[model samples]
Target chain A: MEKEKVKLRIYGMTCDDCVSTVTAGLKKQKGVIDVKVSLKDGTGEVNINNKEVKPEELLRNEVFTRPSHYKAIIIND
Target chain B: MSEPEKFDLVIIGRGAAAFSAAIKASELSNGEMTIAMVGTGPIGGTCVNVGCVPSKYLLEASHSVFKPAHPRMPGLHETEVKYDFSKIMEGLRSYVSHARDSKYVKVIENYSNVKLFTGLGSFLDKKTVVITGPDGKEVGKVSGSNILIATGSHPSIPNIKGLSNTGFITSDTIWEMNELPESVAIIGGGAIGLEIGQALLHFGSKVIVIEAMDSILPQTEGEIREALKKELESEGMRFYLRARVSAVSRSGNWKSLDVITHKGNEKITVKEIIVATGRQPNTEYLNLERVDVKTDPRGLIITSDTMKTSASGIYAAGDCVSKNMFLETLAAREGVVAVSNIFGENIKIDYNSTTWAVFTNPQVAGVGMTEREFSKMNGSCSTRTFSLLNLTKASITGETEGLIKIVVDPKDNRIVGMQILAPNATDIITEGAYAVRNGYTIDDVISTSHIFPSFSEGVKLAAQSFIRDISKMACCVE
Candidate 1:
């Protein structure tokens, strides 16, 4: 039942606006408890309720595909 | 022709019920079965399309305007709020569109087997349905082994003379109103009437509510109804009780209503008339008789607790089958039940546990049986009423105009029902509903802790009333 964390390298970022867009997207995901999107690193750190969601599902979220340019890939290591 | 289009299930609605059934059917069949969903009007049913979304949005939006001008706190300066009413209406429409696309339209996109058909679906026979376009031409035909009659309800216009010809707005058509009327006469005095009437009154409209019953919210707990009447009256909203609209006639620039109030017959004039008498199930064009589906005298489709119609392979749910309450959540639940029964399971809907709310300021909410219903059903029950004046939250917030009433069966000490009339009562009633649904005792309710200084704390205090005089109890006492 522990909270799970996922780090993603988000694309199509040019300004703080992209971070906000990604943050809103991550927050809307199921089981998402907390979301922190860094404009500098272009990374989205998400805390999720593990029972209802898995880390891999974040890569498949519509937020990445809707604009057809914004993308996210799970960061390894 | 070789053959007509065939589906595993043909759902007769695009709203909550049909959407819910489509999801359940997908789950049951593992995305293997075909589903044909036919609908009329908007895609998201009454709630998002016309009823809850736009109505509640305006209520809260206008609150920003109305509350500042009519300041509750004594020290606060009365500041006038101004805005273009048409722009606000436009904003409401946009919000409704976003909500519908997200909540209703996109929810079903995951199920590829479920197909959407835009038309009015009518039963050709028990197994077949024909879709008709707005032009009154036959659009298409589809037959399913199983059909779900999830067609919900529409606003009911009363039989008053010239009501239709003279023109009036119901919940369904009120969204089209761009300009705020100078004054309005709202009929029914029910949840729909009071909620919208209060919102318009907040927006500086001269609002008069006419109720055929002796009191507003006649179906709610008596004390809750009385408290609501008092609260609304204090806000300068007018009421005409034990009244009926005899006729409606439109004159130059205004309309006149011949109303038979308890005192005497009075002719009232208003710029707009809103009929909120109630809603009737959307079954008129369904041709249910062809399928041997039975309906109550009120024209609601009759279905078993399991959501099965009298006819085999046909099931009904939502406002079409609901006896008293018409809610989106209830409709979705009934849809699930119908789909489950169709797929061979016996899941019954427990009406006793159904929780609903009226979204007037100082909202009204209830779950389970009232003292009147409990006493009549079981012959005896104990009760307690906890006033908002005593609740620390209500006192601190300066919104002490409501009460919570809990009904307990004397024999078992189990809480049979709970009714609340207070700020955020709608959200708080869920706890009461959970208790009544599972036969939780008064002690159980008291054992669980509620957040202090919160409106929901009233539920705990009401439960505590059975054991001791909660009026003298210290705040935050265990």
Candidate 2:
């Protein structure tokens, strides 16, 4: 399986805890290897080792104030 | 080589959620947990900075000005009504600063396990976050085994043509303007738009709200929305429901907005335009693809009931994930849940327990299932409502325009939803949300103690009505 690092442009983050919240959430995933969160521009970077991750799986799992505000996209592979 | 400093946790937001999480993490550790915080805004996040705190102050100030001026009051004072936008904004700004400094920063800095980084934090990896100072200088990186993303959301600017060129401002941007526009068009009738719109209306703006939906407060009950619409319209604000704005143009200092109205094409000229079309998750930059996190079409980061995203060791909270009623209270709640779960506590978020309110004249609020939602879920549920005009407090406050609507599940008498349209509706709905969230029966509400002649009695009345037999409802007192 190809190794992929994904970047998530996060919105609705207010402080360092926001970055930590997302980082801690992603770190719980089974295939996730690394998680980086940026509070400056409201973005998160994550590393995965398998093809098991799907966007729907993530969307179905998170609790947000309004789920529509945040998005995760693959910037590289 | 010096050994790297190993921290137990790193949080990236400074709001109630971040600080609270830090406090909790500190307590959980054996006096050895190292927590790092990176935030760009003032110490407090949205709730204290640009969101609830400041907005509510402005709302209260304006409400005080308007409440005494209503026609229904017994005796009218010959006092002139006016709002100095700058002064009100100044006070709010000062309050926000104090809240951030005294409440947020002081707490974080005082925590022995926490390291505060007053800058923008970017992810070097899942375990490392690089902090950049306001001057664009690299401060340092804090690498933690567990990273929490509490970065809150911001206002979502739509993709309307020429919107940016027209110099339209969002809720976050409007706070800085020294002068309020005499005439302004607020697009999107959601909480932010409506709250700011009502504030501006009281502040002397001829506010016009253009909503894409058929009614304002879309998620609320129809009756409450209707009541709010009537009250706001009576207060001199205009509503253009089912209106779609196609283009915006600016000529010199004035602006022209082209809207596709239900009747036909219309052009509105206003001094300013506020696009409150709702907020998008601040995900465009966070390089989620690097971590393989998935988002919905609207850019909401996908997370689970546990606030965990797709990738391992990552978590998302606040408005960044897919959820509705993007409120500060909800965000704070989710923030606590996300962090606690990360520290090995197994807890799931309870969406049904969340309460939402739109700060408007005769404020609108809803909790649990709205009548619409309940009816959609089970076709047999019934509704009962109590008008504020029937309540003595409304007469005293002279705000008798809205009502309380309760949706009850007929089979088990569960209070599924409650909606309110009245002054202090946001504050009043908290009790109702607690009831509904706990699946309290309407009988419980009716049996509870309520102050005599209070607007909250309306809730008790509606609950009583729902608990009564159908024969009594059909032959009730006139």
Candidate 3:
């Protein structure tokens, strides 16, 4: 299976705790191979198996939905 | 009897400022610095003990109890929730104790170089302090190369006729009561009074808030203040603006307050009275004058940007020192800054981006200048506000009662200030703080993708409203 790296501009992270929360939430998503969230730049990068999961599907997951109060926008690079 | 103990740093008071200083000093010195902390009061200071922690806990409990009857959704039936006031108080005490233990006491135990002394510390000289126990006896003496006075503030009771004689409870003492008052007259409509007033009202108490000024929340924006007042008033909380309590006297089992308002003199009777006027610095016991340390007229210790008192090697932070605002985060930052400067780094405290919140039902928070402040300086600045009524998320949650106001400097389109009055304003204000701190413009905020059906989208909506009519735009339109 092929794997792809997706970079997202995460919003509403105020501290390291928020970064950890986003990292943990992303890692729980389907087909996610690895995740790294940065507080300094307010961005997150995740590697996922492209054959099994789509990047847009992961972007619309409940992890970035209401009640969690965080958002992520994929950056096309 | 023996020689006075000496160390590298001596911190007086055990609140946020003192703990922050000790922790930062320990980190900077790689846990090798010897420090002595003398505190006669509670260990965790105001934030963890009586001020923020307990108050917020009670507020949340009140919110839970009030939610059933005041559910905003249609077809949701009101349900009764019975509560034991004493049990709630017990829970609050336990929570405060747990927080203090985990956040302060246990954390301090790991710093082997730090010593804790439960006593009042007064300056013997520039580098020495005589510790006195609660019994007023001299316990011991400790000397240090540098000293920090983070002794926090206490609630200031007004000098009303017969006030002291009639007796009253303050925010500090009110927590000790097990039974809720049948009716409470909260004096001075500041943040504490308003918050406590609303909480008590929700907990089934008849609450009346009296403010000597024409408006409540004197420091907040006028629109925000009016909006909050209207909301609370609709919920049956009473308010007497521009009122002065001329006298307080007891009548049977009730307390009577003779208030002089704009209309005329009126008498208010309540089962209890809470004085939330303001706070004064805890510098009285520090013997600051004896040590020639300067203090403002209000008894707040005067300090330089580096947190240094008039006496060299003596520094102050937190509510004890003069600053634009008193907050736990700001106090901690000041402590860290002071320690960095002491360790040969040049740093100054900056409050331009300091954010604060009043924990009311619809929390009021602001970062940077208010509309009035901006108008006073520059008349050319543009302002935009979006009501929660138009925000999709607020409507979905049935909490469309607040508004977000953004003030921008049109010259460079940079956001100068932002004020939010919403259910989660406290959590959302930090985004505005970041924008104002980094000089982000309205376009920067609007371009960022906010989660749909989220309170934070209010920021983007307000920013978007500046360029085009938001009502004409689609839900996810840029």
Choose the strongest candidate by lDDT: 3
lDDT of candidate 3 at residue B393, scale 0 to 100:
84
Off by over 4 Å in 2: A1-77, B1-5, B132-139, B467-478
**What are the lDDT scores of the predictions, listed in order?**
0.86, 0.75, 0.87
Q: What are the per-residue Cα lDDT tens digits for candidate 3 across B346-391? A: 5898787889989988999999987778878987778888889999
What TM-score would chain B of candidate 3 score versus the native chain B?
A: 0.98
Question: Against the hidden reference, what TM-scores do the models get?
Answer: 0.85, 0.81, 0.85
Q: lDDT at B256 for candidate 3? A: 98
Deviation in angstroms for B266 in model 2?
Answer: 1.1
The sequence of per-residue lDDT tens digits that candidate 2 reaches over residues B1-478 is 2233445567777776677777766654433356787787767777787888878888888777766565566677645577677888888888778877888777766677687878777666666677778787777777765666777778877778999888988778776877878899999987888898898887778999999999887787777778788878888989999999999999888999999999999999999999888777666656677767778998887889988888766777777778876777777777777766664456798888688888777788888887777777788788888887667678687777888888888898888888888878888888777887788988788678887777777788777766454334431222
lDDT of 1 by residue, B1-478 (tens): 2254887788999888888888887766557567899998888898889988889998988778888887767799999987889999999999999999998778878788888899999998888899999998888998886789989998888899998888999999898889999999999898899999988988989999999989998778899999999989988889999999999999988999999987899999999999999999999899998889999998899888998889877889888984788888899899988876654445798788999889999899999999999999989899999998989888887888999999999998999999999979989999998999999999999999899999989999999989999989999777
TM-score of chain A of 3: 0.93
Candidate 1 versus truth, CA RMSD in Å, comes to 13.6
Which residue pairs in model 1 clash with each other?
A: none
Clashing residue pairs, candidate 3?
Answer: none
> What is the per-residue lDDT of model 2 for residues A27-72, given as tens digits with 9 covering 90 to 100?
8877777888888855567677768775324433352223433333
DockQ pick, better of 2 and 3: 2
Task: Kindly provide the TM-score of model 3 when superposed on the true structure, using C-alpha atoms.
Answer: 0.85
